[model samples]
Target: MGLFRSIVGGISNLFNRNNDGLTITKLVDLLNQGYSLLQINSNIYDIPEIRTAINFVAEKIGSVPFYHVRADNEGNMDMINDSFQYVLTVRTNKYQGPQVFWTHVATMYLLNNNAFIMPDWDNRGNLTALYLLPFTQFQFAQEEETGKLIIQFQGNSSYTFYYDDIIHLQRFPTFKGGASKQATGNYITMVNAMENQAVKDSETSGRIAGLLQTKVNLKSSDMKKKLNEFKDTFLTAENVAGLGMIGSEYELLPFNFKDTPLNTEFLNSIIKQLYNYFGVSYEIINNIASELQYEQFVDNTLKPIIYQIEEELTYKLFSKGEISFYNKIQAETVDLEISTLAAKTAFYKEMSYGTIMTRNEIRRRLGMPKGPPELDKFLGNKNFQSLEPGIYEVGGQENNPEDGK
Candidate 1:
């Protein structure tokens, strides 16, 4: 039944083949004659009027998109007509009795209709006229070097248009909007402010130096006399800028002291350790300490040895292909977990005044991250959990699923 319907449909199409100006038979003939709607060569080149018409429409639209115009032969023009296609024509001086003639193919797109129709040119007596509907078919031909716009449109009838043609036809308004432009005066004002701050900072440094000499013991002859000249020179010339400590009535240090240099060597050692482990600078270490002073003070002992120990541990772990093991504490040994206790109790503790506080001090010396308040979260992490009672279980095997199978 399907085959019978198909046969009838073919017969019907065959009879009505020529309804749209050209028949299937004529199209086959054109192909056999080596001429198609999309011909490799067209005589259109010789027709200046037609060439002028195409250029006029193209220029009015906008810059010809790079993909639209194509070149093949030395002198040839290829015309592609899609549903959104426009083909402008200019009448030649000599006119044959017209079945139809067209001047300008007005730009219009018929999306739903899916056709490229050439509209009829409005004609008065002397002027010729023709109708153009959106063409249902299109042609892509290699441009020819010469000839009139009239092509031997006899054989090649089946045509196709590219989707790019429809996209190209879209109109876009020129955009001129942008962010507000900064005035020259605004930039000059910023430059001036920056320069003024730099000058003020220089003046402040000078004043600070004067204050240190006058109010601080820095320049006292008696103070100088107490120190060996070599030690004095070393201490004086180092980059040990002092910080002023202002104390309240209840504070441990009740008076405000300015420019009292702290131990430079100690600070430098701390900075060196931080830099070696983390690749930070002295300035960065100082900034971190100032920002989080309590945390910095807690890890005071670590300041001297963190970088070295961390480096050594990392190397050892790599070479051994394992971490140094730690023993897990049993429930009964919970009392031995000194790091968790607030104070020490006299027992079998290693340190004098044996207590959890002392163990914490030791841990701080080892440069560990802070202990957790909740034991579960803390013990869950291997770094913290390893501190439990047992020694490491080295060379332990973890079963592979594949091996078990």
Candidate 2:
């Protein structure tokens, strides 16, 4: 059966919540049923730091425009305006454009280090639409009788599909038939503790203003009243900065937390490792990166992902003979696409004069929508051009290039 029909059949089989791996310290409603607080604390998407890093990558990778191209005799690759490239660069399906589709795919890939893309095929096995497969868990096995490989997804409901034409992206594959399952496991406990501590600190920050010790032997009820009075005097927003005038017999031990923040440094230190694991720095995540830093991020982090997608798309979408003849995908990182405004302006200055790039091409880099087809041609430098030795229309007379200005 076709993958789409199978998915429609399996729509009722949403995944059941499973928390088999974690020893729960807290339960989180932020994530879906199976994901607990402990699970999220361990560098999953729920953690703010980790999510920021992952989203930075996902959005950037998704934002990158792709191209389908073929090589000529000069070894230079030229873009081909075919349906394949159009679908990848403009629209993936009826519902999603390039950004949303690729962002989701990247998120899934980064989250699991494994993802599957089912390429719709025509009657002749030519590529058509693409779909991102949905599954909470998956496994691969071979049929004993047919000896054909099969992939099973145990989500809300279980469904297995033949491995035919299924593009599997896996990192660190293992004998167990999937990517070697590794996550941010090095600092889960510490991160959980720190996160909890921070929450507790935030909750009781002002309430625990100081300790009050008195020599007066008061009843429990009276003591509660007195404590309330003290808290009201010092903890209340109106008198938070006011000095307390306590009796001589009482001791005032103020809880000094103004100078020290809760778990910020320690948490950042631990989460920095998470960022490093995902191949992003704070500069990249926060978008405060320099040109050098951005380039390094692209080279160190984004290149691997782009390469994997390109290779897989090329191989799966084309036959070996087709590939040998140079039909392939080329994921060109549009210079103006992900570049900063300053970089775009500088690039425009450099290329706007000479016929280096077409107007629409430059406009694309600047994040502008495509203009009319007339702008598709290269721009000529009008600043200085050799005047042809012919009549020029000027002041009711013809001026030639040889006629000096």
Candidate 3:
């Protein structure tokens, strides 16, 4: 209760001081300005390429499970695999589950260069639920004298927290710019080009029905009325399909379009550029990537993002000693492919020769159920054995010089 009161008092002091230094009102005004900057800039999310890039990264990361781990003094680590299962699998927040929450966070981080998560703590201060704030809705500022970060949410809401209480995932490195500062979105530079192309495409399609001009020399008193009737009938859809004129004096001229249709190759090139910029190959988008390419994509592009999230989560979620003892988050690698029984046999044979991996370990890697407890022990081929002083034995027979004769 005392700690809570102190937090409230500090916030009150932040809001009231208007003349001496930074005030809450001034901060709010600054935040509003920052928000306006985002509004004026074209939203990268609106562009198809940007959306595809963001989705590709976010979905890949979110699909991997995040685990808590235990570690020993000797630096050995093992997953407390099921410890975070409830939080990760059931619900991370009241309204959203872990997948949705993480995907949204990842998407927002890619768009604005930052993402935030506020954990809902129980009475014991353990995390009970989590909420992801919209990146644009919050402004980050630091108190001038104290150097404490202040997070101001939309409207009159404001909250100050220790760095650990809030998960702040930043995509780009920055020396300054507290929380409010944003690194430019990766796709922002191409927005105008994409928009221009879209407009050109639309205009080109509209001109496919070429312009028509009609000329008539009229001498009668009812010429104006006749001209109006002629235009109405001639311009109709039915008449355009099968245009005909009863009078020879009426001359209809069709102006053929000279400009070629928008080059699909050029448009496709732009899309390809966007994909390449985000490290997504055409084979991936078209679903033609081979197994090797897929693995490369995950390792080269996706793994770094997963590592970033892992480091941040590990640091923020646990104390130094606690982390060394029993807390970690890991992103699981994609499942390995064993296409045929021959491939599986070859892989197992290689792994088993030197007792490199136990039977259960191989089974686990192959996604099969665990074997009996004895299978947990390392086993090698009984037929091949090492004899005294580098001598060899094959098929239970000793290759001794005396016995060979």
Name the lDDT of candidate 3.
0.61
Best by lDDT: 2
lDDT of each: 0.28, 0.67, 0.61
TM-score of each candidate? 0.14, 0.68, 0.65
State which candidate, 1 or 2, has the greater lDDT: 2
TM-score of 3: 0.65
lDDT of 2 by residue, 1-405 (tens): 123434443221221223121111111222335532123124467677777877888898887777788887789887877668778887786557888888878877777777777665454333456776654377777767677776676644555665555667766566644463556676656777788877877777666666777789889898888878776765664476556556576678877654445667878888888887878987777668788988888888888888888988887666677677787887768562447778777677677667677888788865799999988987777764788898764343255444543
After superposing candidate 2 on the true structure, give the runs of residues whose Cα lies further than 4 Å from its correct spot.
1-43, 76-78, 124-126, 136-164, 173-180, 206-208, 214-244, 247-250, 255-262, 336-338, 345-405
Expressed as tens digits, the lDDT of each residue in 1-405 for candidate 3 is: 123423443333224223333333444465556543224124666777767877887786677767676767787768663425456666876666888777877777766666766545443334455566443455557768777665554434444444445667775555532244333343355455656766876767656343233355555656767766766876684567876454455655556563544555766766677776666777877778876777778777777777887887777655576665657777766332333466568768877876878989988977899989999988867656665686554343365545533
Ranking by lDDT: 2, 3, 1
What is the model-wide C-alpha lDDT for candidate 1?
0.28
Count of backbone clashes, every candidate in sequence: 32, 5, 0
Candidates 2 and 3 compared: the better one by TM-score is 2
The digit string of per-residue lDDT tens for model 1 on 1-405 reads 123323343232122123444333444454467543212212332223223333332232221111112224464434333111222123211221111111111122111112122112111211122122223233323323332121112223433222211111111111211111212233334434444455566565534222111223455675455334434554555647543332231122233333433444654454344333222334433344343442343234222222222232233111121222221110111222222234223332434232323444444434676555442221232433336576544443466434432
